[model samples]
Target: MAEIQVNEDEVQVGAETASVCPACQALLSDGTIQGKSVLYCTKCRGLLLPIANFLPLVEFLRTLRRPTGSDIQPRDNSDADRHFTCPQCGKSMTGHPYGGPGNVNIDTCESCSVIWLDRNELQRIVMAPDHYPVYSRYDSGGGLRRTN
Candidate 1:
């Protein structure tokens, strides 16, 4: 496990003493999205999310999606050419298209079980057309409500 320290402008990884952004090599800052903790790069707007937290977040997002009449699209290998090293383990991370309805490519570090999402990737997933189970779900009369 990596110990994370979050100050006003930077995040430090305890064992290594530094946690730089995978996308921009800039220092990362601690941040939260939908109340889930993450390390964010101010320069690149990329995010580093723990797999433990991300899985539940994805499950919650899935609950918001309307049932798809069709199956998900097949994944593409266009992102395979790009590679990233894990900030925690210093091993090469695997890049693959996210398995959800969205087409964003995400990087995962198997050793550390962390994920790296580039700028706007999360927004793309959240705004995907298939994700709108019903716009009314956001209204007071609906059963669902935004948490963060």
Candidate 2:
């Protein structure tokens, strides 16, 4: 687990990322990102699940700034094709679970519906070792709001 000092003020932990796809690393074809959105790949036009949510590009980009330019050591979570409803919007989601173990994992809203993180996901992320660029402002004290 890494630690990302977001914007100097708030330090959002465990938000590290590797270089995205080969061509346009940041945003995939129809706008996908780190284990988030299922966007149509530009070159292939196939439905590829991005790193996370295709919701907020700005936030994703902000959190992706790494000093080292080497590619990320890709993990073997390739079989994560199950669909779960977005806790905030009730829309079906496709992608990997964002955040680390201790911290709460957030089911990000599709197209920025609303970000909902489970209890441990946030803590695990903040407590990670490497740390990504995007930082979450110290907002939630008690975590996770189940709307359904």
Candidate 3:
């Protein structure tokens, strides 16, 4: 089993099962990042995450992460065209730019219901500015309430 350090206070113990990374073809180690289970590639620092956990993981990380005040770097347009085989299912993964804040490209294997994030991609998404649209509704008393 492999042990990974998440931070000063948290240490992630690897699972007994072994898997390979789809990005770099390196061994993927099981561990938790921000309390969510994930298969992490130590070589390329990529992450293989269950589709169900992706949103929750992003939300949790964004909540804990503050803006670094550094300029947001642009994502590589070519990455959106790259494809990879799913490590779990051996199927072609769909690559696309995430429709969220960070402008990061993500690869998903719908057959296996998994998402792949390259090195620093998670951090990019969390650090990107939150730009959710705000909606306003009128209450029973005609008072405007903001929803978002």
User: Mind giving the per-residue lDDT tens digits that candidate 3 earns over 1-148?
Assistant: 8754674212264763457787888888777876788887777878888989989888887777756523344566768777798888888999988888776899999998899998678877876667533435655654333443
How far off is residue 121 in model 3, in Å? 1.2
Give the per-residue Cα lDDT of candidate 1 at 5.
Answer: 50
> In model 3, which regions exceed 4 Å deviation?
1-17, 132-148
How many steric overlaps are in each model, in order?
1, 32, 0
Sorted by TM-score (best first), the order is 3, 1, 2
lDDT, candidate 2, 40-137, per-residue tens: 32332222232333224325443654433322222334424534454324466545556442232334445635443322233234334353334334
Q: Candidate 1 — what's its lDDT?
A: 0.65
TM-score of each: 0.61, 0.27, 0.75
Tell me how candidate 3 scores on lDDT: 0.74
Which model scores highest in lDDT? 3
The list of candidate 2 runs beyond 4 A from truth reads: 1-82, 97-106, 131-148
lDDT (CA) for every model shown? Answer: 0.65, 0.35, 0.74
lDDT of 2 at 98: 63
Error of 3 at 72 (Å): 3.5
Residue pairs of candidate 1 with colliding backbone atoms:
66-133
Encode model 1's per-residue lDDT on 40-145: one tens digit a residue: 7777777788988876765665565555422222234566678788877889999887877556788999989899977556545644556533222344443243
